[model samples]
Target: MKLAGLKSVEGAHDESAWAAAWVPETDTRPSLLLTGSLDETVRLWRPDDLELERTSTGHCLGVVWVAAHPSGVIAASSSLDSFVRVFDVDTNATIATLEAPPSEVWKLQFNPKGTTLAVAGGGSASVNLWDTSTWQLIATLQIPRPEGPKHSDKSGNKKFVLSLAWSPDGKRLACGSMDGTISIFDVARAKFLHHLEGHFMPVRSLAYSPIEPRLLFSGSDDAHIHMYDVEGKTLAGAMSGHASWVLSVDVAPDGAAVASGSSDRTVRLWDLGMRAAVQTMSSHTDQVWAVAFRPSGGSSRGGRLASVSDDKSISLYDYS
Candidate 1:
């Protein structure tokens, strides 16, 4: 597989774009792109041509993450101020505003069945699950504080959750944190299962392979991406090349490769089988914050990869 630049939007946002997600195709429209930025707005874009469709604003601080529900009709955008705003993807109408105060929100994902939403609760040291139908708090999967003196040494502070991903079947959940620990949980039971360890710096992103439910990938401030066997709790492999923190990672819809954005101002595509970066795209002049692959199944044919960067730009690429 290979990637060819399809289009690039310079100044896509007024500030750094921190997150990106694909909204699946609906009866009326093809798949679209959703992006959140430090500019405090969430923008929707048309693919291939990378055209700006609409910009939604109401966020109080920098938008950190954006998650699209499975139905393609609804999406949630969370900012640094700890508020999650769920809105209609097409009409841009407000659906619900959620907050778990005393617990800051970072990354978010909607379960495969669209029954629940999982959010990385920073500093609370837990994953907050919300009922999608009622928009109510369902459960908090708390990570147990580490044993010994470090617990009192404010180690929980170091355990601040950063990113999250759901297994393809939606039976399991995994979250990465500030202290470099990856916590896996059973979704049905809402129970903490185990932790995957290796990287020493904050794990900023995580993605589970769509084809291999047990194969999980993570990107970290250490500038390396590690693949893990979530069920076996083993570090399967590590891929490195970026010069700075690896800010985001996403597995291709085909599950043949993984894509990553980094503080190093580049986007790298890694061949999973080879366990190395096979392609690098340095189109952005500043730190690349997020990279995402369009979910397969739409009028949109072929694979498309989107990257947003601190340079206030967004780029779309054709992946084959």
Candidate 2:
């Protein structure tokens, strides 16, 4: 129900830390923290003391997003240079390097089942799905252009895809665009379903309730966090507090609370039923770019929440 500061790593990266995710536990080791920074590197960290386990290089123009597969063995990251790199978690061995040209890569994710990887395709207004086994591009779920605009119209860029989340059931995919629209797609059919509208600014991050496949939370430059019932295509509620853009949003492992990091230089944890922020951590000096709750269940639930910031630092908190 609350978070207590456990540790903070100053200068965790050479530049701004842009993304964070928890690599699930493996047979040999416990769950690990995965983070990407504007320094063009991704690093793995062991818990509690936050020891650096591995440093991964080769990305350019900064790493924009990072996602760990459910199996805890493989991870995928995309860079501002427009390439998605999939690699082994323990050895940091490159598994695949993917890019769909003329369709810039933004945030990328592995589905709950770890069978498919979805990449937000900027400018293309589509979500590119890859078959995890063969690393083959399977399909592109293109967002339909608005009714009247010509295909060549420059205004089309407004719908640039930036963030995405897969439902717990793995049957649906939801993506957020720059135009403040959240689009849902049916995975089996590879077809766009509908749009969830509420925010009018860039939706930077999204997270789904692990317990409810149809519930979604989105963060936007509009400086608000919106909860939506995607299945009903309705705005369930909105929480307001951050003074600047909300850069990232995450749902707690138990689904009773939500966490957000923002340009306001703070991380806020919200009480779900009350629909309000219960606590705000302001240890960060600059914009907080990413916030992630460690993925776990049963005995290790609500284990940890990590927020990385433009200040080049990472702060970890114990949530219970």
Candidate 3:
């Protein structure tokens, strides 16, 4: 798949578009792209043409993260206010609202089975697992504090979790923290399993290869993307090219190429084996916050890539 710039709506929102994901097809509509922005709104875009379908409002602070249920009927968005709003993707109705006191929410993901939703709880230093049907807090997987003297603002770098991912099996949950640590948790036991360490800056986004449950990819403020062996707990590979912070990373469905969005205002396509960027699209004038490869299982023509930027624009690319 390759990118063919189709349409870009400048000033699509009032602020940065922080997150983007594809909502699978339904009976009436093919499939829609969902995006969350710093403007405190979540927008729905029709692919290929990149037409705006709907704009959702309710968030009080910047919307930092979003996730779609596997069934495509529901999706969730989290903001700086530490609250998560789950809603109906097609109807735009509220499904549930989740929150944890004093602990902000950053990133969220629904299990592959759509039975649960995992939220990255910032200050709480844990992943909150909620039952999808009842929307009740099912488990809190907290990352254990390291063996150190004391943790305070001086060490704010350590315990703050920023991003989260769930293994395809839904048995393992991985969370990235402020101090550049990624923790894996055993969902069944609700216990912290281990930590993956390498990046020294905040790990802002994480994704698991659709084919390899043990392989996890992370984008960090350090301006690099690291591939990790989640089960083995080792750094598999590190890919760097972006001149600024790497805001988001996503793997193509075929598992051969990965795409990243960066503060350098470009979207890069990296070849997995060569561990180098093969293509760079500098179409956006501002920092690109999110770049997502359209997931398979729909009427999507060719491979599609969607990117949202600080310039308040969304660009759709055709990945051949």
Candidate 4:
């Protein structure tokens, strides 16, 4: 698949757009794009043409993260203020307000089953789980502090959790941290199982392959993207070309390509087999924070990509 630039909406939000996700198609609407911005607003966009549909606002500080439910009717976002807002995608009605004291909130995801929401609990070194049915805290999967008396000597952000991903089977959850370590947890037991090692900089984003439950991809501030065998606990491969931090990554639904957004102000498409970037789009004037490939089998006439940037812009591309 190749990307053809479609439309770019300049100043789509007031500040840096930190996260983006494609909401799967529903019967009433085709498929919508959801984005969260440092301006403290969460927005919905009609894809292909890049038209604005709605904006949901209530966040006190920067809206740093956003995630959509598997059913496409609900989405959730988190801010630096430690609040997680789960709301209706079409009506903008608040469905749940989840909070954890002292622990800051970062990236969040609704499980593939659409039954639970997982929030990366910053500083608390844990991932919090909430039941979608009751909106009640169900479990806390804490990452054990690294073994060493000097562990506390490190900076506070070292163990600070930043992003998360749920395996397609819904049995495993992986969470990334500022220390560059990814914690793998067993959901059934709610236990920290092991860690994945590779990136030495903050691990900002990660995605589990739609086709392979064992394959996972990660983007890091180390200016590299890594492919991991999540169950094998080994690095499958590494891809590098970005001049600055790689902020986000998502694999194509077709399973042949991967897309990444970087602080270098570009979006890159990587051919998985070659393990290299084959295409770069530099339409954003500032750091591009999030990039997402639309889920396949949608009403969309063609392959689609949605990206948001620190330049306060949103760009859509036709992937063919």
Number of the predicted model whose TM-score against the real structure is largest: 1
Candidate 3 wrongly placed segments (more than 4 Å): 147-157
Clash-forming residue pairs, model 1: none
Q: Write the per-residue lDDT of candidate 2 for residues 129-218, one digit (tens) a residue.
A: 999999999998998754333234566788899899999999999999888888999999988888888888999999999978779999
C-alpha lDDT of all candidate models, in order: 0.91, 0.91, 0.87, 0.89
Candidate 3, after superposition: displacement of residue 272 in Å?
0.3
1-320 per-residue lDDT for model 3 (tens digits):
45677778888888988889999887778888999998999999887777889998877889998888877888999998778999998778998988767556878999989998988878877778899989999888878765434334465546788888888898988898888778888898998888888887888888899888889999999999999998888999999999999989999888888999999999999988899998999889999999998888766667888899989899888876
- Model 2: residues >4 Å from true position, as ranges? 146-154, 298-302
Task: State every prediction's TM-score relative to the real structure.
Answer: 0.97, 0.96, 0.95, 0.96
Candidate 4 wrongly placed segments (more than 4 Å): 147-156
Per residue, candidate 1 scores C-alpha lDDT tens digits across 33-149 of: 999999999999998788889999888899999999888999999898889999999888999999867458899999999999998888888888999999999899997654444
Clash number for candidate 1: 0
Worst 10 residues of 4 by lDDT: 146-155
After TM-score superposition, the amount by which residue 37's alpha carbon in candidate 1 deviates from its true location, in angstroms, is 0.8
